[model samples]
Target: MRAIQITEFGGPEVLRLTELPEPAPQPGRLLIDVDSAGVNYADTHTVENSYLAASSLPMVPGAEVVGRTADGRRVVALTDNGGYAEKALAAEHLAHDVPDGVADGQALALVIQGVTAWHLLRTCARLAEGESVVVHAAAGGTGSLAVQLAKEFGAGRVIATASTEEKRALALELGADVAVDASPEDLTDRLVEANGGRKVDAVLEMTGGPVFDASLAALAPFGRLVAYGMASRVPPTPIEPARLMGRSRSVIGFWLAHCLGRPGMYHEPLDELLAMTADGRLRPLIGAVHPLSEAARAHEDLRARRTTGKLVLDVRA
Candidate 1:
C-alpha cells in the first residue's frame, strides 16, 4: 500500500509518499479500501506537532475517510490515524454506510465536517428556529455545511464571514442569508448590518485567537459561542469573566474527536445528519481533488487557504 508518512514532525515538506505493508482487519475491525480522504486543519496541526494529542513519529495523519469495508459495503469512517493511504483499518462501530447517491469524495467530506456542523447546531449550541447565527470561514468545509444546517434548522438569518470575497460569495450560495468579509476591523458592525441590526443568538467560531473576543462581542444577550478550531495559528487566549457577565453569554469548546470517543453521546445526531445528506436536505461540497501521492500539496493548499469547501484526496488515483 502507498501512504503518506511523517517520519518526523516539522513541516509540510516532511510528509513523504512511501510504500508500506498492507493492513489486515482484526475481529472487531474492518480493513477498508480507501477511495477518498478528508484533509483538515487538525491534520496540519498534527504534522506540526501542535495538536492536542501528539502523534507517533512516522505516522500517517488522516482522520476521516470514505471507502469500502471488507464486505465491499460503501462506508465512511473516522480513523485515529493512517487514512492517507490506499487502504486503512477501522473499528466497525466507527464506520457508517454511505448513501446511494453520494460520491466517495462527497461522503468523505461530510463525515467529519458535516458531522461537526450537525453536532454544533443541534447539540453544543442548541440552535433554535428563527434565531440568528454568525458562521466564520463560511466558505470552508465545516462552515459551508454549518450554514446549510443553520438554515435547515430554521435560523431566521444566517450571517457568514470569510477572509475573501470569493469565499463570501460561496457562503451565500450555500445558504447564508448574508455574507461579509471577515478581515475588517469592525466585524461586529458588519454582522449587525447583515442581520438587520439584530444581535446573533449563536456564533459558530472555527477561527480562534482575536476572533474569539470579537465573536463574543457579536453575540446577543444569552447567546452561545461555540469554539471549534483555531485556524488562525494564534495561541488560545483567555476570556475575562466580565465579558461573559456583560451579556450573560456562554462559550463552549467542541472537538469532533471527543464526541467520537463517546459514541453514546453522538450516535443519534450522526444518524440524523447522515439522513439529511442522504435525503438531499444537505450536500457536501468537494472543493478540490488531489491524487493521494500529492498529499503534501493538499496540506499546503489547506494551510494557504487556497481552497474552499471540502478538500479530498483520491486515494485510488
Candidate 2:
C-alpha cells in the first residue's frame, strides 16, 4: 500500500509518500479501501506534535475518510491515524454507511467537520431559535456548515468571520446575515455592528490567543462560546471565572474524540446530518481535491489557511 507518513514531527516538508505493506483488519475494526480522505487542521497538529494529545512517530495523520468496507459497502469512517493512504483501518462502530447520492468528498467532509459543526451549535453552544451567533473561520469546512446549520436551527442573525473578502462572500451565500474580515482586534465591535448593534447570543470560536479574548467580549449576557480548536497554534488566553460569573456567560469546550468515548453519543446527530445532506438541507463543501502523493501540499494549504472549504485527498487519483 502507498501512504504518507510523518517520520518525525515537523512541517509539511516532513510528510513523505512511501510504500508500506497493507494492514489487515483487527478483531473489532474493519479495513477500508479509501477512496477519499479529509485533511484537517488536526492532521497538521499531529505533524507538529501539538494536538490535545501527542502523536506517535512515523504516523499517518489523517483522522477521517470516505471509503468502502471489504464487501463494498460505501461508508464514512473515522481513523485514529493512518488515513493518508490507499487503505486504512476503521472501528466498525465509528464508521457509518454513506447514503445514496452523497459524493465521496461530501461524505468524507461529514465525518469530522460536519459532526463538529453540528455539535458546536446544537450541543456545545446549545443554540436557540432567533438567537445570534458569530462563527470564526466561516469559510472553512466546519464553519461553512455551521453557518447553514445556524440558520436551519432558526438563528435570528448569523455573523461569519473570514480572512478574505472572497471567503466572506461564500459565508454570506451560505445564509449568514453578515460576513466580516477576521481580526483579533475589535472583533466584538464588528460583530455587534453587523448584527445591527446586537451582541451575539453564541460565538463558535476555535482560534485561540487574542481572538479568544475578543470573542469572549463579543458575547451577549448568558451567551456560550464553544472553543473547539486552536488553529492559530498558540496557547489559549485563559478565562477569568469571576468575569464569566458576573455576566452569566460560559466558556465551554468540545472534542470529537471525547464523544467517541461515550456510547451512542453520535448516533442521533449523525442520522440527522446524513438525512439533511441526503434531502438537500445540508451541503458539505469540498474546497480542494489533491492526489494522494500531494499530501504535503495539502497540509501546506491548510496550515496557510489557503483553503475555503473541506480539503480532500483522493487515493484513486
Candidate 3:
C-alpha cells in the first residue's frame, strides 16, 4: 500500500509518500479500501506530535476515511489506523453506512466535522431556540457546518466570523444572520454589534489565544462557549472561576475522540448528519481535493489557512 508516512515529528514536509504493508486484520476492526480521506487541522498537529493524544513513529496521518468494507458496504469511519493511504483500518463500532446519494467527501465530512458541529450546539452549548450564536472561523469545515446547524436548530441570530470577506459571504449564504471579520483585536465588539448590540447566547469557538479570550467576553449572561479545537496552535489564558460566577456564564470543553468510548454518542448524531446530507437539508462545502501523493501539500494549505470547507484526499488517485 502507498501511504503518507511520518517517521519523525515535524511539519508538513515530513509527510512522505511511501510503500507499506497492508494492516493485518484485528478483532472489532475492519480493513477498508479507501476511496477518499478527510484532511483536518488535527492531522497537521498529529504529524508534529503536538496533538491532544500522543502519536507513534512511522505512522500515517489521517483520522477519517470513506471507503468500503470487505463485504462491500460503502461506509465512512473514524479510522484507528492512518487514513492517508489506499487502504486503512476502521474500528467497526466507529464506522457507519454512508447513505445512498451522499458523496465520499461528504460522508467523510460527517464523520468528524459534522458530528463535532452537531454536538457543539446541541450538547455542550445546550443552545435554546431563539438564542443567539457566534461561530468563529465560520468558513472552515467545522465552523461552516456550525453556522448552518445553529440556524437549523432555531437560533434567532447567527453571527459568523472569518478572516476574509469571501469567507464571510459564504457564511451568510449558509444561513448566518450576520458575518464579520475574525480580527482578534476587534472580535468581541464585532460579535456584539453583529448580534444587534447584544452578547451572544452561545459560541462555537475553535481558535485559541486572543480569539478565545474575545469570545469569552462577548457572551451573554448564562451563555455557553464550547471549545473544540485550537487551530491557531495557541492556548488561551486560564479562566478565573470567579469571573464566570459573576456572569453565570460557562465554558465547556469538547473532544470527539472521547466519544468513541461510547458508540451511541458517536453514532446518533452522525446518523442525523448523514440523513441531513442525503436529504439536502445540510450542505457540506467540499474544498480542495488532492491526490493521495499530495498529502503534504494538503497539509500545507490547511495549516496556512489557504482553504475553506472540507479538504479531502482522493486516495485512489
lDDT agreement with native, every candidate = 0.85, 0.89, 0.90
TM-scores for all predictions: 0.96, 0.98, 0.98
Give the number of the best model, judged by lDDT.
3
TM-score of 2: 0.98
Cα lDDT of model 3 by residue, 174-222, tens digit: 9999899898998899999998888889989988999999999999999
What lDDT would candidate 1 get against the real structure? 0.85
True-vs-predicted CA distance for residue 309, candidate 2, Å: 1.0
User: What is the lDDT, from 0 to 100, of the residue 30 in candidate 1?
Assistant: 80
Clashes of 1: 0
Error of 2 at 15 (Å): 0.3
Residue range 1-317, candidate 2, lDDT tens digits: 99998888999999999999888879999899999999998888889898888889878879888888989899898988999999999888888988897888888777788889988998889898899999999999999999999999999989999999999999999999999979778877898898898777999988998888888888889999999999987766677788899888999999998887586567567778888989999988999999999999998998898998899998988
What digit string (tens of lDDT, one per residue) describes model 1 on residues 259-288? 776756555666777678778888888899
Candidate 2 local lDDT, residue 277 = 89
Positional deviation of residue 208's Cα in model 1 after best superposition, in angstroms: 1.1
Poorest 10 consecutive residues by lDDT, candidate 1: 263-272
Candidate 1 Cα errors over 4 Å, as ranges: 261-267
Pitting candidate 1 against candidate 2, the one with the higher TM-score is 2
Ranking by TM-score: 3, 2, 1
lDDT of 3 at 206: 87
